[model samples]
Target: MTLPTSDTRVETTVTEPGQRLLTVDGLTVSVGGLTLLDGVGLTIDAGETLGLIGETGSGKSLTSRAIIGLLPTAMDVTGSIVWRGQELLAASPAQRRRLRGTEISMIFQDPMSSLNPTMRIGRQVGEVLRRRGVPSVEVQRRVIEMLEHVGIPDPERRIGNYPHEFSGGMRQRAMIAMAMIAGPSLVLADEPTTALDVTVQARVLEMLRQVRAEQGSAMLFVSHDLRVISHVADRVSVMYAGSIMEQGPTVEVLRRPAHPYTKALVASVPAVRTRTAIADPLPGAPATPADRPTGCPFRTRCALAHDRCVEERPVLRIVGTDRLAACHVAEEVSR
Candidate 1:
């Protein structure tokens, strides 16, 4: 791996599918002495999907932003973010710019704000290709093909439409088209379906699944909805107070959570086939990184908290086969 630092630089290389695409280790982000993300680690293989699930302010979006180099200049970031074999933490602005849109793409939650209100959808989607020196005629053809692949109706007619002219779902499809136009190796989707209704949400999710299948691209899917994560993710990471509480195979972790926080989150999801009572809300306000406690970040809301939890922070450890949790009592409580 090439470790680029302030005084060193390296050339970027193309990575193939079925190989490690992104590796984040001990990623920490802070601004004005307030920590937003602490020691967060994640890995995504080419063509694999990793779901990041947490409540609002759990650092899920922050993690994605940090990876994509979208964080504010005031924020202090330290840690290793390796894409393919290149370290990104110390990479130059031009290096990151070269990677964005072509090697990596992001689909924001609100398409209305993310899409250019003044620009036509076709022009916006094809801009990346044109910037990379693709011929105008070929760019137009590829843009139309991508728009149709993402389920946009009447691509020929809608090509001239502006952001405001499309419906919520249609606008999101356009966003996906833009993100996929360059055939990025990694896609960061931060709650892309959160703003749509149930029917439209399902359709959009299906479209993403199809697109990933065809493109064979890795994805870091961030969302607060466990139901959505279950449908789309192969592995899942549970985040809280800027720390990862637990992570493992999606079905295994949900069925038998090892950490207290993961247990509470899984319990909160409603059952469909059987009649079940609503779970009681977790007591206390969600923890914030600015005022987080000394030890385990989830201890404030964890029923299993003890003196050990209060005095010493727990790092991620093996709780089961291919599973890891950051709780001292993980073995005792793991089901």
Candidate 2:
């Protein structure tokens, strides 16, 4: 396998003290004897956004779920989820519950499922405050403020509306307001822009960017859109099947990806046509997690796959400064 040469190495600076917010270390997940995640590691620093991009079924959503303790009871997790020096994965139920809304929050992918149709929009957002024993009056005040903060114009008139009463964009805004009501320090957004019109998609992306900047929360923005990730991501991680294929600063990784799967994903973006005057959508769908080939899950689709690639699995290792890639043909890919 192609490993980083000594000359290619560059020293990395550790961020300022007390800035590390969330960490997922060697996180492994299995369901019904099927390994869904194979030792994924991610760290989100305070006030930075990490965009995780991949095709569907690449375990992006599962990584989000695993962090929030929302993974199904049928699955087993073997790893540590540390937050501010505490091991959250092993925290007691009450401790986990306490940390959930006050310290960490998740804006789920689907607004329809995330919201309560029976609950008024204002009440839904206020639930977080109420759970913390804040007075009802304060909850109402904070919920309305959040509604206005999330770009729901004239929030006072719409506070009583239910989920079904609002348009898709409005509903999504409300969901954002709810997740962020308590002013948590970390947010996980899973496909926050899916199914929205282009204009609304841009608006929602702007809203998320605003909240993260104003609140200074570390964020993990998960999606399939490299173009969208390019807009708001400080760092980018390209995932394949169930493992990270390549990761680095957004600009560097996007411009010179060292993994074939990552290159294929970037080339498949429709917007790439406008810039490069050509597009090559990745052929074939992703391999199922349960049936991935032994050597490398992506070898079947990689253009440069060789005999060694098909016979031995490649592990993620340093390829450049602040960069890691899992591919036997890393040198060929970089060129």
Candidate 3:
């Protein structure tokens, strides 16, 4: 079936290049007196995609949840998350709720868990608009049109189907449709293609790119795979032990990493276009946020770790043109 070319709910606006859409500074999250995300900071420009890349428990997801005000009530969060000049942390629960789905939407990691099995696909997809008091007929029409745009076969028939009725890839596309239906300014996609196979992964990635291009929505794309980040993000922030180790243009950071951990990560990925040999796995286990060392958390596994690294924590600093690296020997590492 053909894709939907236009929808009344999906509005696109022209923005100045490099305009700031979201700014997150010194974001920290803690639970039970243990810090999970420490001094994390990130920025997303208008119509730009920023990738948050790191291992699974490195606080990447925590950062996104904080941005959308989804953290558990027990957790203590301290930081500033500004969206289009408004501070999100200071906003009341009612205000945050209003912005959550309409202005900022998130695509969760697992579609099976995310999409309610009991709910019909059409109802789930159109839930946001329905909650906003949109006419039921219009919501149904838009949901079907969105399902078609996301490449679901015969969306008119499939709209009445349940979550289990669709394949893993199709479920994800429905998730995308749900996120995009509101025409959100910022989309936080947390490993949106992790469950799919290689072929399906490629298709989902392409669809995401097309959707972003059409809607002009800025994205915070989080994934553990650097290769995936290379394909999707214009800029990337590499996390290690709840802190950003490196942040810069994706191509530059991948080409010549400015931190030892980043270097090791790059070396571990097998080159597809070249016959380059992949480096041996890193020596030590990844550091956890709660059990981190006194100085740099990555120093335990870093080959370049020195006496200075043990005594002092390195904060993120400008190491190159538009590049920020948190390393004691950043100058030497960049060379």
Candidate 4:
């Protein structure tokens, strides 16, 4: 994603009532020789879902880690991550920890490890309450309510079961309850529905929506599945090789995508019962951070690449009303 120029950030996007609860500005993440994220920026509003979609190895998950301060020690991140007007990256570790799992919670992809094998689900969920100094009676009640909220069949029984005792889908529900029990304002859901039966996936997603609706929590949902992202996200940001290629309202960007990469990605989703279907996947694989093209990281894979694409890096300039893309040829591509 092309980052905001220093001057651009000075002119903050016009803030409506509760325009943003979280804003990441010109964030860059590097691990020794590799630049995992290059100037990625995004905003998640209160009570909104922002779908962050990208292909595998595109740094989608990495971006999530950087937000929650879960990246490995080797990676150095520089940028401003503001939550409720307080800078997260700039905050002390103790301060960040205080905010995490209470003000901001994240549902990690793998539920097995996320939930301790030895701990019962109820205890894990109540741990947050304990840390917050809630009374034991209230913690138990909240844990049971959370279990039921995620649609576990037998909430009371399942609450006492260890992680290993629960099935995959059930384990996921437990994880969701744990992440959400604190009633965080922002929830980072990193592919929480992947690899589940279609029916179960729908249920989980619906549960996320309900959680947001009932609690008024904002969400940043990361996924490679554009289809799934489109279903849950109000706004969408498409990423490629650790940068946002295009971003706008979900329907607008998907219907009239400005970037060549976004167009290819939308076309590539496998649909049901389509005859003579052909997915025009982008021509070349995304480059590693170290070897990105001089002018455009996506230039080598773009069908509309020109000499200038290889000589002058394209910034993510606004092309449409309320939309941004990092492609010199977006205007012509739309034509």
After TM-score superposition, what is the CA distance of residue 315 in candidate 2 from its true location, in Å? Answer: 0.7
Candidate 3: tens digits of C-alpha lDDT, residues 164-249: 99998889888988988888878999998877778768877887787567666789999988778989999999998899999999
Q: Model 1 scores what on Cα lDDT?
A: 0.84
Ranking by TM-score: 3, 1, 2, 4
- For model 4, the local distance difference test gives 0.81
Compared with the true structure, the alpha-carbon lDDT of candidate 2 equals 0.81
- What local lDDT score does residue 113 receive in model 3, on the 0 to 100 scale? 90
Residue pairs with clashing backbones, model 1: none
TM-scores, all candidates, are 0.92, 0.91, 0.94, 0.90
* Predictions: Cα RMSD each: 6.2, 8.6, 2.1, 7.6
Q: In model 4, which residue pairs have backbone atoms overlapping below 3 Å?
A: 1-243, 1-244, 295-313
Best by lDDT: 3
Question: Judged by lDDT relative to the true structure, which candidate is superior, 1 or 3?
Answer: 3
Residue 79 in model 3: shift from native, Å? 1.1
lDDT of 1 by residue, 48-165 (tens): 8899998899999999989999999999999999987899988999999888888888988889999999999999988888888778887788778778766788998899999999
Backbone clashes in each candidate structure, one number apiece?
Answer: 0, 0, 0, 3
- The global C-alpha lDDT for each of the candidates, from Candidate 1 onward, is 0.84, 0.81, 0.86, 0.81
